[model samples]
Target: MTVQHEPDNWRKSSRSQNGSACVEVGSFGDGAAIRDTKDRAAGYFTADRDQWSAFVAAIKGGRFDA
Candidate 1:
């Protein structure tokens, strides 16, 4: 699937400091857009609303804990 990059407003996480390493996120219709703050022109990852929600929940639940 081709992911279209939108001009929607992108915001970095508040935890981002010095604008060095960070991720930017924005809403694209019923989905979400995520891109590296350091390389906005490269590419981004998009996920449906439900998928995004589940991913966020997993993160909060430490499903990726190692």
Candidate 2:
């Protein structure tokens, strides 16, 4: 998925204790953008609302554990 416009309100994950290994999330009208906190210039990936919801659900369900 691609974001049609630049996302706003970029913020890092609350779980980020140290700055080394973290990601930042930004919000657009239709979806969200995620990028490496250590490398903002590397760009970001976007996901539509549904895809983002599913991804979050999977994470909460431990689908990505390990």
Candidate 3:
């Protein structure tokens, strides 16, 4: 399915430095959109809100970090 990205509310990761190599995320109702900040027009990836939350939690818990 095609994802609709709202650039206006997209937030960059705090760990992003100098706006380089940064990803941006925006919430759209029950889902979230994620895309490369440097190429927003290229399109985005979308996930259910709950899945997004779980993904974030996993990242914070280092479940996906090597």
Q: What Cα-based lDDT does every candidate model obtain? A: 0.84, 0.85, 0.82
lDDT of 3 at 17: 97
Q: Which tens-of-lDDT digit does each residue in 8-41 have in candidate 2? A: 6898867679756788888967778999877889
Q: Between the candidate structures 1 and 3, which one is better when assessed by lDDT?
A: 1
Query: Which residue pairs of candidate 1 clash?
Result: none
Winner on lDDT (2 vs 3)? 2
Error of 2 at 29 (Å): 2.4
Between candidates 1 and 2, the one scoring higher on lDDT is 2
The order by descending lDDT is 2, 1, 3
lDDT of 3 by residue, 1-66 (tens): 876546468888787798558888888768788898688779888888899999999999999888
RMSD of each: 3.0, 2.9, 3.2
lDDT of 2: 0.85
Candidate 1 segments whose C-alpha is farther than 4 A from its true place: 1-5
Worst 10 residues of 1 by lDDT: 2-11
What would the TM-score be for candidate 2 when compared with the true structure? Answer: 0.84
Model 1 C-alpha lDDT per residue in residues 1-66, reported as the tens digit of each score = 866658478888787797658988898768898999788789788889999999999999999999
